[model samples]
Target: MSSTANISTRTPDQLGASRAKAADNSTGKTPGPHRSKHRRLWWTTLAVGVVAVIVNVPWFNALIVSFKSDGDISRGALALGHPTTDHYANSLGAAGYDFPRFFLNSGMIALGAVALVLLIAVPSTYAAIRLGFGGRFIMNASSALRLLPAIFFAVPYFLLMSNLGLLDTVPGLILANTFLNLPLAIILLGAGFRDVPIELEEAAQVDGASTYRILYSVLLPILAPTLVAVSVLVFIFSWNDYLFALVLSSSNATPITLGAANFVTSTGIRWGDISAATVLSTLPPVLFAVFAQRFLVSGLSAGAVKG
Candidate 1:
């Protein structure tokens, strides 16, 4: 009986020691869940930052080059040596190029195109969504238009503009941009309008509001973010457009796109001036995108949720 009691006591103590050793081992070397997660997150963040720098390096280099002299730039120089705004000042002044006039012209054309797109797209999109007047057909037609090459329109548009005496004017360029961007604007705005709840429109109608009034007050406010997004997109399209501007604009009403083209002539190219002008021309769209990105995210999220 004593021997059996001693075996039981010894077995229990041995088991206790094994368990204590296991606990100590676990505490000493085992990684916590939070630490593993943090490590993974750090690696992901570092990878993304590296990719961002790689992608942005060219733009950064271009900006630096724009401020350097022609001699300094040609020797594979990366940094700004004797940073000078001479390129910018000359480009804007009579000494370099007619960039100031070109900028103004492009701005007007882009603004006009955006206005025209909103004016036409909003009503058409509203009709397509709310009234359902051949909505599917319209959407499909717009999509089909995208398949046709833009060059196909060039000849016809040129002839039509000539006949209308709009060849070489801001109005002519605006019209062309409006035509190019209209389908996209209609599709996006139509999708946005479709996401708007029917009950909200009905509620406004119940208060004895006309269709126009309801659209103006309730629907417009709800669609504000979408509108801003579309406007920014339209502006970018109009600003970057080179084809229409090149073909249609004359010296009297030339935009930055065409003016920039002039930098490379039969003679030697003006690399510094061209680089500076390119940077300046890109600024407005960049600023617009940065400022409107939040609204775009919110609008897209809202549409997704509603859908």
Candidate 2:
């Protein structure tokens, strides 16, 4: 069917009706279908807004109570009060919570894991996408491996780390994190690399630029945002890991996710302090999500189209 209401090929009576419809549209009377669509759009937008607020209620409550005193938290999770910095201090180890140490350990593992994942993934993904040597199989295998249960791999990694005397150490945690998250990094970073026009690579080759030089000087600049997005995702994964950290670490390499449990000991739950710790722990991932959101969006959108 045509979009125009004025169909010249219609019968005389049909043309009269079409002319009346076109006049109605021009005069803004339009039709019921368009009005119904507008109503549906407004209703959907309102429903989405309500759902978003509902989903974020808990986070808002946590933020509110994190600033309250131990006594004041009992008032309510959403209750407002003049806040104090005491919980922040205690959460950061002012009262011997060891958050600083936990932060250091988490940072070491997260940053190291991101570095290792990218180091292995970048060139490999680039080659897989561009070089075309069993690229399809490589992608399929990585995806399959990613879907396997963590325990399947963790058992072997545990034994290996134990034999290497790396258990309860930063490097051990980093290794575990990198191993678990590497496939995802490859799939994501490769998407950005895949989007890079092959003509650029060929042009560089024609100019006598080596593969490594082209990758470093030409591709790296284009991939900076993608790199940041990948790094942030990997960092969040490593930072928020509870299972691998719990299974692999003892006292030597406790991260914030595990260390946060200290507040729930037999001494009774320190709700205020826990809330504070939770709030602080939320910052890194949130900051990274905010900063790299554009690149992440672009990467995902491109991945959808290209893949």
Candidate 3:
């Protein structure tokens, strides 16, 4: 009884020390959660850095080649030999490349296409979501149409535009690009539209506001961010279009994407000029995306899709 009482009376520190000694003697180690966590963090950071490098390699190579001369490119693709601005000068069409004009042509077509897409898609999406009887069918049909590649429409559209005397013109490119953007615009803008409360729309209707009035006065203000998102997407789509521009237009409507092919002359591929043009051509969309990022954040923060 006395021994048991003494054991029970032992201080907590002594008991803890005994248990620690026993544990050390038995296993000689303990695995810490923090050590494993640190290891995982290190590996995750390394993987992210590696992925970023891989993704940027082509753009980095383009950047390096843009500053280099044609001779330097021949020496090595990754090598940074003496850099010069002559490629940019030549590609800018001062030396007869027509880069500026093609860039302007791309902008006009992309912006015009965005306008046409909005003009058609906005009303159509509104009607489909709010007023149309067969909204699901309309949306499903749009999705089905998207599955049909834009290339499938190219030859037929070329013939149709040619018949209308719109071939090889900016208007021709605008019309084709608009068609290309419609499905995407409808789907995206429609998602935003669906989030709007039907109650407000009903109230406006009860007050005798016309359909167009409620759409413009009440809903559009709330949908500004979403509208910006759709506009940017449509602009980028038209801006980056190559196949349609290549198949439909020849000279006056050549976008930068198609015009980039001009560097493949009979004398051999002009690598430096091509690189310079690529860098220039990529700038607008990149800049636009950068600028529009604020709107994207604002829109998402403003509202979300409802069940």
lDDT of 1 by residue, 263-290 (tens): 7663787677777888899898778656
Instruction: Encode model 3's per-residue lDDT on 1-307: one tens digit a residue.
Output: 1122233235666664575556556654556644654665688789999998999889888888889987888887656678899889888876787778899999999999989999998888899999984659877777677778888898899899999999889999999999887877777677778878899999999999999999999999988867887788778889999898998888888999888865555367788888888998898777875676654333333322210
lDDT of 1: 0.78
Minimum summed lDDT over a 10-residue window in model 3 is located at: 298-307
TM-scores for candidates 1 onward, in order: 0.82, 0.81, 0.82
RMSD of each: 14.8, 8.9, 13.5
Ranking by lDDT: 3, 2, 1
Which of the two candidates, 1 or 2, achieves a greater TM-score against the reference? 1
User: What range of 10 consecutive residues in model 1 has the weakest lDDT sum?
Assistant: 1-10
Superior by TM-score: candidate 2 or candidate 3: 3
Q: Compare candidates 1 and 3 on lDDT and give the better one.
A: 3
Give the Cα RMSD of candidate 3.
13.5
Off by over 4 Å in 2: 1-46, 75-81, 265-267, 299-307
- Once fitted onto the true fold, the runs of candidate 1 whose alpha carbons sit more than 4 angstroms away are 1-36, 78-80, 94-96, 296-307
